[model samples]
Target chain A: MTEKGSAFLDLMGGEVFRDGSQGVKIRLTIEPHHTNPRGVMHGGVVASLLDEAAALAIKELLGLRPQDSGPHLLVEMNVSFLAAARPGDTLEAEASVLRMGRRVAFAEAQVHRGKTLIAKGRFTFVMQHD
Target chain B: MTENLSQLGIKGEAARSPFSGFIGNVLEERRPGYSRLSLKIEARHLDSSGRLHPGVLATMMDSALGAALRDVRRKDEEGIPGGTVAMDMMVLQVVREGEELVAEGRLLRRHGALAFGEAEVKKRGDGTLVACAYFVFAIGRGSPR
Candidate 1:
């Protein structure tokens, strides 16, 4: 899941990986621009990373391809920040598919800096086909 | 002479933001328990689906809710300052590039070092709600835990 066309990922930065060969995961380095006023990883960045991971996971579970399955949109997402990450820190996030039905898919995710959990959340993804 | 949230600090922060791309985000105003922010949708903000990226909306809620919570912390007489520690959000509608977004957040309550808050975002033109969120934060004057 390169998501090569997403400029947001290009600017904010993210790397997508497959989870268990069935789920999706994202890795991001806490960059200078990713920090907030206090210099910790911005909550916005955390949220975005989670969303991206969830989207990737959903696509994997649903077998939705960019050229075939249309598109996947976030129906809902929630995140809880457990710890703070700083610039130069490499954070890895992974999403789990809790369930996948007809229209919606549920997922849970966590971002960790090595052993430290930075954040965790769940998401609802809805697949739209054209 | 201001010892709090100096103009220079805000200006300096606006520079390094990751969302400072095409559909750039701007911090418009901040007040105790409340804040207003906006983003101008740009071509680059779109995803592979040719729609506004969900992460962008999440980022907006993240920044807006955090800013509002920051102001709320400033008002705390205890003199504690921290940052947004947790957030839960929902995307209620779809969005696209070229559509400006306006977001606002207000504090729901504060207990000790923790603060609870909620925020909403809508299209600037028709005020159609696109997304909303609730946030929790921990603040301290020196380093927010």
Candidate 2:
């Protein structure tokens, strides 16, 4: 595990899964802040989790550095909400790189509540070099 | 025939595109390259940090860009059409929850088969800049094809 993964785990209070290419898996509890009037988790909350999963996966791919000399910025993304998660349910977001080019990288993520897929999306990021 | 796109999940009022039965709402038919919207943040859109969820920011910008693309393309077409696909995007800043947010999206430039646009999100109360995003949408002939 990279230091960045460990740090992110500590920050989010979730364990980092062991996987090739540093794919991240974090289980999040759907709290009141994440629920909707229907008592299900808000779609926006799922989006945030997907975003975090993509961003951290990029950081892990780059290697664990104390200072970020080159920053990664998202250029575009399209997400689909397929299911709803309720409060108290444990949701997990998993992210991985679909393709990494010299200037841009493609990442895909799926947010799940146990075995049910709540949302998934593709993200394009521009890598800034120092 | 005039149909409201919001009703079909094409637009949302301060949230996902909420389709109302009302006919010909001006917000849905905004021009391509120039789409604007304002909404007062409510309790339903905040995160644990009491800030506007990034997903909301993403959705708002995506809607604005999608509107611009829809307007711009239909203006040139000869027949009834559908919608575009948002291929990718990035949110640059965190939006504060409960602040009235003003969103503006402009068609930046276009590459063949792909259109690029930028959206700026700002706080309505103090006008403090919030999040900005760039999106690339795939253009097509008609409704979400």
Candidate 3:
């Protein structure tokens, strides 16, 4: 499945792809606007990508459609920046669900530039049901 | 020296980073060990459900934390050179569009080639805490200005 129509995601220009029973992947090309003063991708952008990927993984794990389910609130997130990604680089963020409970879910994601790991994140989300 | 610090503000040419500018982060104040910034929620800052996006909050917190460290280091005769290595953030309340939020960051400590900081995001009107975050940064030697 391909995710679309999120204003914030559109602003970031990420392409989402879901693999059957595996997880979700978000692909983004580093633009000049994404760079920080050091001319590399901003750490916050990396964190955002990690968070989104992880959240999407949880959504897939529960088999909930975006429109049908209630909003999933991100309770906590931890990100570790391993390396810097420069402009013009293509980074792919892949995520998987670690555990899913009745109301809370745990997921993790890693951003990579080919073999180079750029960042990783773990997320805790409160899954609301309608 | 003060001019350089002022350049980090919204009216100055140096302002924040490109990403910060793109996200409409406005630097309100910066001083030793502390920094303040604000952002007005827009349509582009919301998720599909019309709620404030977590990524936007993370961006604000990350920028505020880094700015606090940068403010403190600006006083050194050398220059400021560093980057965020890790961050942990928790959302205390959910925000929505049209809410203006302010983030205040405080540098907690600096050790050998490392710095620690924390930040709080609050609603501009009622000062309700929206989020809190902690950051770890690696300090280096370079010409920041």
Maximum-TM-score candidate: 3
Summing lDDT over every window of 10 consecutive residues in candidate 2 chain A, give the lowest-scoring window. A2-11
Best by DockQ: 3
- Which candidate achieves the best lDDT against the true structure? 3
- CAPRI quality level assigned to candidate 3 from its DockQ score: medium
Cα distance off (Å), candidate 2, residue A61: 1.4
- Every candidate's lDDT: 0.71, 0.56, 0.79
lDDT of 3 by residue, B1-145 (tens): 2222434555341245778778888877777778778889998998666788888998888877776776555345234445789999999898988999998888898766677889989999899999999998876543443
Of candidate 3 chain B, the 10-residue stretch with the lowest lDDT total is B1-10
Ranked by lDDT from best down, the candidates are 3, 1, 2
**Tens digits of lDDT, candidate 1, B21-135:** 2236776767777766777777667665667777788777767666666545444434343567877788888888788898887888877677788889999989999999888
Error of 3 at B59 (Å): 0.5
Clashing pairs in 1: B81-B139, B81-B140, B81-B141, B82-B139, B82-B140
TM-scores for every candidate against the unseen true structure: 0.83, 0.50, 0.88
Better of 2 and 3 by lDDT: 3
TM-score of chain A of 3: 0.88
